[model samples]
Target chain A: MWTSRRRTRAALVVAALSLTALTAACGGADTAKTAAGAAGGKGGGAVLKIKDPGNSGPLAVAKKEGILEKRLAEVGATVQWGGSYASFTATVDAVRSGSINVLEGAISPVLGYLVSGKDIKIFAFTDPVTDPAAPQTDGLVVKPDSPITSVKDLVGKQVAVNKGGRGEYLLLLALQEAGIPADQVKRVYLNPDQGASAFATGKVDAWWAIVRAYPEAVAKGARVVVHGRDLKDQDLNMQAARTELLTEHPEVVRVYLKVLQELTAEAQKNPEKFQNVFLDQGPTAVSGPRLTDEIARTRYAKVPRFATAADGAFVTDVAGIFQKYGVLPTAVNPNDVIFDLKPAA
Target chain B: MTLEKVPLGVPASVKDPVEASVTSVKGPPKGLTKDLANDSANDSANDSANDSAQGFAKEDAPEREVRGGAGATALEPPRYLGGRRRGPVASTAVRVLVPLLLLAAWWYGTASGAISSEILAGPGAVVGALGELVATGQLGDYLLASAQRAGLGVLVGGGLGLLLGVVAGLSALGEELVDPTMQMKRAVPFLALVPLFISWFGVEETFKVVLIAVAAASPMYAYTYLGVRGVDRKIVEAARGFGLTGTRLAFGVIIPTALPNILMALRICLSVSLTGLIAAEQIGATEGIGYLVTLAQQYYRTDYMVLCIVIYAVLGLLIDLAIRGVERVAMPWRGQVAAR
Candidate 1:
């Protein structure tokens, strides 16, 4: 009888558990409804969900200056910011799920999503990679005392990089040009923080990472081991959106890109605005000289005309690298994944 | 059930008394007496001849002695006659029904198509993807590499674990010296150590394998120590009475007695090692099963990702099954307790 009661009790417990699960499952449907409401000018006004992974950079400035939001507010669109440090996966998931309309980072990511059968498009361009006299937007650095003086010296040494990003692809290209097969060098794929710590600790011989850390590494006695230009190629990382989102809301896309260009102009005209944004989001109190160096390195001070064929070729070439490096499934023409708009003439 | 005439057949103790009784009831009157005499003669020849003429004294013997004494009655000992035997058919049906039911529910849930494929892949797609991988020979290569690493780690880890655990269990000084350190090591999360290990070992295969081995060693060490310590003092004393001492005493008495616990530790270690190895492979290696999962995710092959997870689950289950088989072989005395 006790055994039978135990069995009955177990059944009851299972049923109760299932019912609780059902309730949780039902809650997902309610979330969709809330999303619909949020989409339909609910939440006190028109709410726009923007995903910015870091508080640093131009987005930080835009947030503090309140220019983009102010512009959107005039059109009845209330802006909300969400940040993540979870890599492109998180940002891609958000945009693909329609939880966010615009992901402000690398445009090269569209090829990744496209290979996965996503119909997303790059709606706007962000940072530029020009300004050869200035510091590189992306570079490989090594410890000051280390023997790795050039790209050729990186052979048989560990170099930290993110697998899909421009850093890894460019690093591959740099190694090839240096007459080193990729297999000769061990590539340690890591996120920004991991790569940074590894580089700082001398765990990795070199770091192929974002340019934001280039000056910091230099300050810490890690030399500008290899610039992207040393490899003889250019890769542009930019802001983008789903093609459907751009098509249905061309006015919003146009206005957003125009505001971005205006912000770039504003930042270039006054370096303090850029420094304030960097300080608010980072290791505070960057010095005047350091700020100038950072400003100089922040090459997107001039937003590139994103619709030109030259720009299209640049994106296409990067996508091809993504394929060659095995990060992307296949090579996709940038035109297939981009929507061209002549920046309001 | 009335008391029947006692079957004079084998004095009701040899060939089954029940079967003899039935035979007696069915036999012709002319053959009954002759058959009964022949059965008694056969029983006496087999039993008394080999029982050292202690056949009548057997009733006072231990239960084990009784099973060792004679014919059909000895064959069906308390152990043999206990527990309902589950037929192959019922067991097979259970095995088939359980996974099939789970697969059906999964298919139904995913095919309803409400859930995003990225978060949760459909069963059909996962199956199709596995078939494709298998056809492409990639699955075989990945599995081989992963299995080799896991096997090596388990052996090395389990060996070190047993050695240290036994030493720790035997001496208070050893336990005092190692216990706190072991506990601290176990407390540190395995994933956090990956970056450090990668830094130290540079994503080499040795580092990956050793990392997993280290992860596996902890639980094994703890379990083996506990198992050795938990051995009955009386059993040690009893073995010592027969001149067994030190290593012999441990191997012959303590280890056998603590075999179940030691095996349990090994099982836990196997699983922990597998988890650590998979995580290590995921972060760094270009080839193992975990690398395949990452590679698939990079390409947005949801089906292949699902397949990798399924393969991992199956490997874990198979390891557990192998452990159970070893347990049954090592502990024959278990059958006696089950009878009780």
Candidate 2:
């Protein structure tokens, strides 16, 4: 016979199970409903579900100031701030699943996803950094005491690079410029953390450090062999939105970029605060003076523009480079991936 | 008192009354001393007897001169398992010394320029950064979020695991139905399931939680299943003989006996749930300690990175302490011995 206590326990368990089942069903429906179009809020207005990059960048500034929300409201569209993603590439998978509809990131890594039949489109992009004096987003580095000084010297040496990423691409470009065979240089593929370790411990002769790594390596007395500035026009910071969202609500895309540009310009006016957005909330690897110097020397900050079709040419060359390096499994048509959000004159 | 000078196990009948004063002695037979009491032959696994002997050993020296005290032919026959317990002060000093030494080494390395600030921030910098996190209230928010995820994941996962384990352990039909499938699921790495889960559930709170749940569940199920199966069959028979049936027999008889192992499973589940936390929060987490790590990594903040590591290490220590507390409360019948 069932006791009252046991019955109560059973009832709680059943209740929990039912709640879980209902939640899972609701979530499944949410993915489908939001995947086909911009998410409609309870008030029947478009909700642009996007990951607002926090702690740094124009996106971070925009998020902090609610620029997107305020601007998009003019078009009956509201901005929904989802948290940022760790992996730029993983956000592509998120976009495909309709977990998010807009992704802002460095575009090189995400090419493979686009090549492999993901329906995402590059609607806007920051024009390439042309000035050689600009702060290089990433660079190849060596120990201060190491014998290697140039890309030519790196031949036959083990250099750690993030495979199929900007690091490897930068190294490839450097090797090409140095007139050395890419196969001659031993590429030790590793993630940033592992690469940092390998470089510090002399496990690898060189490390291709990216984003935060470049500035940090310079602080740690790592001598740079080459950075993105020394290479070609591959350093295009781009924004992409899903085709469904682009079609259903073009105004959301326009307002988002417009507000982002305005806010980015506003942020750059106080470059010190803008760069130090993290403040004491965390520790930065670079020292105070080093960051200030880099900020001073930084000649350009890429403000994104609605990409025209001409922007697709550089992407085509990058795809060729990716193909040559065997980053992508097969070739993809650049035309299919580039969708113009800017109206032609 | 010199125990080496005393004789042991000598019979009272063999000695004259005047010659052997301790022969007729009751508790600590007169000549018994600490060293002689705790011989290798008397070394006991159970510590209670030793505690009792030690209690009697603490007696003050007698003011009355020993006409027969030293003349006792035999020592107390009670064997002792003796080890000197370190004082709390000494124990705490030893604990404090380790991290201090490491901190000193780190300070020296950084101060002397052997360690670069880029590779690792100085302990002072990390403390400042930690203070910064606290001041901004980021730590509290991140910590609460992480705790909620781990706690809820453990509850849901651990509950399901316990139910399955009980069913499998009690009934052959249940084992045949559930065990093979669970075992198969166990072989698949939980990290590998992240992408699949994102596609299935989408990268929402559900995916993060369910991923943690899945990770927390497996160890729990395995341990619970093993614990239940290992419960004493004789006790189950006895409970059944006493007219207990179904849930009563299992819960009353089996589960109590199996509680130790289940507690161990909880410990493991709690620990590994952190692993799933890292993987889950990487996708689209806005809040949590993992988010701190992600931002730190992205923005190149080594201080915050090190701070996050310290947070994880501290969390691990706290979890272990919590489980130990649970063990003490739940298993009071078990003897308390200093873990080696």
Candidate 3:
């Protein structure tokens, strides 16, 4: 019986090995075809590669609605959306390596890339926070019963933020404007959920939260101490692509930007529809109503036809803040990185 | 090929030399000598009777040597003992070479642009970042905070696990009560319980430490219970024959016998504790190695991230080596057996 069992096992192993060999042979051929297809797109019928960060944002909504793919198809191109990116650096690295064609992220990371000497170009502003009518997304908040009433009271206290990103930048800006020495206030690095919990539990004196979280925090008896919109005139979001991609496949880049512009306009005009799209297609479990409310609170700046001189100046100023905080090693020239797209004319 | 005539019929004279050498080299095996010595000592009160019963001729009887009254008779040198000794320096070199080669590969890959530094920072960049963090005193602070959390979690959780494991392993009622609950907990992934842990303990140091402790406890309980229950029945019976009972029996026989397994369990528990600690710290820590890594990730500082990962790996190795050291001291017999 044991011998029979051993023989059967050996036979099974042989069958499995054969199956694996067959599959691997097929896979190799498929990989070659994919490589060829990806290369072919450089001149014509190229696939427009974009990354989804898995957030309930306009890009995610557009992807879910099939708007990007449909629009690209009109220009004799196809859209290739990759898996959720872990970080902006990963996204940009993909674009630089030609593994991806486009990425959308905050301006700080784009500035970071420019400082690092990567050849990436800002094609369009996705969600610029330059409009005065825009709902305040970034803010500092304090617990209801806490003695820390204002940014001034936060001196010598711990404030929670997702350090080295937008949250830290906003909090530092608030502290600097309040005339509080940087050394006096301690900035505790925590992610949004943890920051909320810390603030609610009094582990931190205050938390730096975005607009979506502000209403939730207030409902939990936390009050906003300062809003980032009030402190600075800034463009928070942008779409970036490799400089090579811009130069070689301007048609693809233009189509992508056009789609993003339309989405931005649609999100502004009818946020509920955008919210419903996000609720159905977003990677998170955020409810439709909450997402709608967040969209309602958000106000987007007018989409620029191209990255202008003023946009470059804004980037330079943001880079200066990053450098001053030691987040950036040195200041970067925004003009060196920002590409003024002329719509393939 | 043609078959040659066989010479198998005339090998008697040739076999003599081989026989002579074999006889010269072979002596009574160590086990036989030791057993004989033990038999002689047990019958020391009747030496003549022992000699007569064993039929040892007066002229051919082996000389006996007693050491420390344990009846350990010296015998011919063990045949495998005369080769050059294995040096610690050679083993240490081998141990160090693997990591050095890996480091070299990483450097080469990055320098040749085979591996993008943007995706993973090269070792040179990581070292520079390490030096910067150390100079600014951030690395030291983060390391201290992380070490404290891991240390406290291991101590508290390990103690509880050891106690519960012993209880469950020794008594049926304890197993019925505690084993089921622990088994259920072990089935749940540590990360899945994070939200529940946060709600229950709040996002404070308490929550982080408790999360690590809970994770550390599961492996400790499993291995300790197995070690205790796996004690040799024959040895326990022999120990019981000596009238040992209760705590005396447990400490004197079971625990010592289970020391090796417990130390092994400790190594695993420490690793699990570090993993849990890192995860917990990632959430709300104001300052820790995990926090440093998180912040580096946000800023896209690959060098800083790699440096923090290397720090974590080194910490794990150091902790594992410390447990191995404890195993060496606690179970010297293990080393003797390994040497043999």
Candidate 4:
């Protein structure tokens, strides 16, 4: 009886091994489907790989209209998208590795990357705060009924901020202006998602809430007790590129910027109509009206201005800040790192 | 012709010596002629070393009697340690050496850009991360927490499983009672129970421990049940002839001989407990190797992730070694095997 059962078990093992082999044989069907989808377009041979670290509404719009794809294609280029939970770090890694030529993410990580001696330069501004739109996505948010009414009140309190991005820099600027030393505040470093959870439970005294989380916090009874406008002269968001990729692939860089200009123009005129593009492509699920309101709130049309030496200077200044804060090495030069914009240069 | 040799074989050792003596009597063969030609090639290395160290060695040749086994045996070396056996040693060495070598390769590959650093971590960064974790004392705390949870999981789950499995396997009525339930229980994946477990137990340390225990229970049940039921019938017949009957017959005759199977069940339970704790840690724990890995990944610290994984692998090996040690102690007749 035992001998018969052992034989049966041996046969079962063999059958299982064969079944696993058969499953592997059918695994490439998904990859083939992706290829078939790609064949629907024949507009360009040059593929322009563009990545957005954040869940930006504009990206969904571009994806919906296929305008970013079409515009790049017309210039003999194609575009691919990459998303990240820690968008700033993802963008920094992408640029450092030359995997992506352009980054449409926040500015802090770009500063951190430059400070870390990576050859990334802020080629254009994507989101910036101006006079009319005083309170953009960048702000210090606190839970309801918290005694932390002002940035000065934040001394010795735990504040959650996404490390190595604009959020960190904005908080630093807020602290600096408040005459609170950076070390005085315990910065609980967490991603936006984690920060949302931390802030909800009172685990964090305050959070540098951005975009969806900012509004989500507001809906959840958290108040934006402080704004980025309160911190004067800040560089909010940037469209950066690796210096090597920009210099070597000048035409590709120009084509990418030109596409951005078209995207900006479309966004400025019919902001609501283009809301679906970013809504579909971004990480977060945002309604069209909400996205339109979000974009309108940023007044991004003025921020993604033509790439200039002043943009380069601001990047250098941000790099200096990163070094001063000891997040980056002190000896690094910003000028050597920033990719000199061809038209601006 | 040589292949057709009739059964005239003598001792092979004597044949080889005689043949070698005959070959020497031939005053060197064609192979010797080749060696003669390459003598100069061999001589150069010997001559160069001699020339370099010619006057250096003899002066103070510290007449140090090589202290053999210098303070070596504080603990007596086992005649045949279970862990030092060929199978276990090879498993240990392969398990450890492969990961270490892979880590070294990963470090070298990424730093040298053989593999892009964006995708794979370099060794220096991983080591630097390990150093950071050590300095912060994060690694030790996570390991201890995970180990304690897994140990508790095995003890509680294994005890319950042993009781249920033995009772169910012993009687026809008991088998019928648990048969359908055991079948259904085995079908449920441990992770699916996490939500229900959390609701009942909350996301506290108890919840994590209970989840691991529950995950461990099914495998232990199957192993112990099968072991008890599958005990040789002849042993039971002998116990019956000796007037041992009822529960006494089952416990005395059945469990004693099925002791190997029970030990094996414990081993299975221990391994499954470890696996369950990892899943528990992954979802909602504040501390554990899995949670540490999640933290590292979130912060983009690939090195820390690698370090945590290495520590987990080491812990698993230690668990297996401990199980084998227990197995040896429980079954003293089966002496330890020699190392390969």
Summarize candidate 4's per-residue lDDT along A214-289 as a digit string, tens digits. 7656655677877776666456566777666566666766767776676667766666554434324211334555
| Local accuracy of candidate 3 as per-residue lDDT tens digits, B73-143 | 55533344323656899979988999999999998999999986656689898888877777667778878
TM-score of 3: 0.47
lDDT of 2 by residue, A1-345 (tens): 344344334334443564586568557756876864443474566677788565555666676667777888888888777766777566766887888888876667768778876568888888766766666677789999999988889878999988777777778878877789889999998877668767877899999998766766777789887767777746477888888788788777888888878766765566655555544345433347666754654326767888777877767777777788677777767678777777545
- For every model in order, the TM-score on chain A comes to 0.81, 0.83, 0.79, 0.78
Clashing residue pairs in candidate 2 are none
Give per-residue CA lDDT, model 2, range B164-195, as digits (tens): 77667666666788799899888989999988
Q: What lDDT does each candidate get?
A: 0.63, 0.71, 0.65, 0.60
C-alpha lDDT (0 to 100) for residue A95 of candidate 3 = 54
| Cα-based RMSD of candidate 4 | 25.0
Model 1 docking tier (incorrect/acceptable/medium/high): incorrect
Candidate 4: DockQ?
0.02
Query: Worst ten-residue run, lDDT, model 3 chain A?
Result: A276-285
Please give the distance, in angstroms, between residue B38's alpha carbon in candidate 4 and its true position after superposition: 64
| Best candidate (score: DockQ) | 2
